[model samples]
Target: MIKKFVFTISIPIVLFGCSVTTTPNGKQVDMLPLISDKNRYLIVDDKNLSKAEKLENYSNQLSEFYGKQNSAYIRVLPRPSYQTNDRFTPIPFMVYEIDSNPVKIFENTMFNPNNVRITEYAQHDLRIPIGKHDLIIVNGLGNSRWFTKIDDVNFEKDKKYVIGADVKKGQNAQIFIAEYEIDNRFKVVEPEHFIIKKKIIENIPIGNLKSVKVY
Candidate 1:
């Protein structure tokens, strides 16, 4: 099961000693990327990681007694009216999370409806609860939306996963799931990066997303 509570952290910018940049899509980037050995995969106390760093480690955090660790992202292929020539562009879809309780992972319609392109697509991924279970999903939008349940999805804490789907134009639109796991190195990106230039005079409240250190 994923952690049940939401974390409301007040980041006072000056804590992270690095410069921050934002992508056109509004994702954060660490100008001075953390230069770790890249071979070390260790987890420290929650207190050790700044709110931003902790959020960055959310997907890959290792533990014997924590929530199931799993991350998944969906891709969609566009349609060119009635043509066999696949219009491999971006299509908006929603990602619905269903366990005991049902929830849509993101408010961004593009991310949920699982949008993507052939040339560039990564930033849009849902870091799901880890463990051995099924990932129940619902894709598409408006009246064309439908349910898709992937059974026995073994989500290992160490191994990352990527799921791709092709949207076929039919009576409506149909999604052909899991075309490939493009990267065993499933796109683990820093969702946000902040560089603290100086200590803030007061506690600051920010929004959008948490700091992502690595991937």
Candidate 2:
């Protein structure tokens, strides 16, 4: 009968293609349901309006307020003719919070160790909080002159914090203080002779307490 109706229509097409569902090293599993109502109308509806939807709903409410807690400060200025130049020359800076992810923080020897020899103009400070950081400055061995500062700091938890300062370039400028640890988990524990090459600055709006100074 036509080979019994071609083996009964190929046995329900081989049992509906073997009713898929494998694993144990067989690999063939796709439960599929990754948000699909036409991709949920591409989000953004904050009650709906115009003007680009109230500017993307105030930019997602300032990206959830810096994505939660934020703070940063890194100021390093050394250019009294490179303070004798011998190597160390880093200048990378960053800050973020407005929506998280953009934290390389700062660089410039963390405010010291660039041949430690300053001759005047002085300022050093490294108070970091809010998240993501890395600052390095070094060229120390002879002439030095490093300065940095970012005000509005008031952090104390188990004490032990040094913002920034390292000088030795000319007229009686002797300052070297670059130690840290003000709670919120900022890093860069000493030892550096110029090696800053990681940077990421995005969103950034921690209530506009934005202070990013680099040189």
Candidate 3:
């Protein structure tokens, strides 16, 4: 039989000094207003900087804590086809973390583009401890897979970070990255919904600068 478990974490007084608000996925929360006057000048709209800031905040919160936590969300898109007249498909997604590895995370069991649909997707959110690790995502059909490494990462208390996936090669394949907010309180907020659209530029042969990453 499949087993299920539920875990709860209480916010501590020291970490609850500031008021916190929650927003739905894809909704942008204003960070400028949350910072103090002295630090407000440092705020800018650089996407990469914003991501790094959130990651740092999250890392600090969970570095000293115990127990694991998670949030769940889904991404829906029309499956891609390598040839005309191919059938539509589904892509299931999830975001999860294990206690033993701090830097590495995983999104297990995804479906490719040609077979993806809203009903075919599922997700789970989990929180665990920090350590070194490996990240892997296996296609449910067992025909394809992706792997990566997560070095030293401290998932902070209440901050969130975004993870993204990209699949440039092979037909009907896709990659997904999810975002999260790790708060000072050491809790995780589900990430926003972002789609990785495919740009079907004609395949260029050797020595094409633009297609180097794709090759």
Candidate 4:
């Protein structure tokens, strides 16, 4: 009886000690670089500096980093792809890759939570090196089985750009990219939308970048 009790206890202990293997079998990918450090300068300002002077200083910083003609800022909007009646509604997109390099967006499982505000999860912005860049976007629906590729996007210097996608049910999604000039107040002004000439992918499976499950 003593041996049986010890054996039963050991079985549970062994099971508890065993680690569960989480094969990257989900759409959740690696985290993207947050805007905390990059955008911190936007909020913190000198008490004596005028708004125009501050903007000029920021512009100088951009010139120092990537030269005056080769730097641009881009912010990817957290716009919805499609809405479903399921638990996860209003599914937003994640940038999978840019210029053939993985964006590795930090996955936030919540479908745009209202009460819980995480700054990293809220913004998908990045300071991209200017020039032609290929972009790949994916959604966190159906385990990231959908994707779209935008190629050869030429980014010019001293411009602030915004990009977003809108998906229609059973149809191709439209990608909207707009450029704006920065004003003396450091605000984006003079909006201009770029016409997309690249082929718009409706949705496709992530074959190479996918995760497999193991039971």
Q: What TM-scores do the predictions have?
A: 0.32, 0.19, 0.27, 0.41
Which candidate tops lDDT? 4
Please provide, for model 3 over 1-215, each residue's C-alpha lDDT reduced to its tens digit, 9 standing for 90 to 100. Answer: 12322222334533343333233333221221232333222222443333334333333333334434442222222223211232333223222123322221211124422322222222222333333333322222122212222333444343233343444666433444334333344212222232233322112221111110100
Give the top-scoring candidate (TM-score). Answer: 4
Q: Write the per-residue lDDT of candidate 2 for residues 126-182, one digit (tens) a residue.
A: 334433333222222222212221222343332223322333466433223232333
For all candidates in order, the CA lDDT equals 0.32, 0.30, 0.29, 0.44
Candidate 3 — what's its lDDT? Answer: 0.29
- In model 1, the Cα lDDT at residue 177 comes to 31
Q: Which stretches of candidate 2 lie over 4 Å from their true place?
A: 1-67, 82-127, 130-164, 168-215
| TM-score of decoy 3 | 0.27
lDDT rank, highest first? 4, 1, 2, 3
Off by over 4 Å in 4: 1-69, 79-91, 105-122, 167-170, 180-215
User: Candidate 3: worst 10 consecutive residues by lDDT?
Assistant: 206-215
Ranking 1 against 3 by lDDT, winner = 1
> Per-residue lDDT for 45-117 in model 4, tens only?
4444443444344334433444446567655453332312354543344445665555332222345332112
Clashes of each: 12, 22, 42, 2
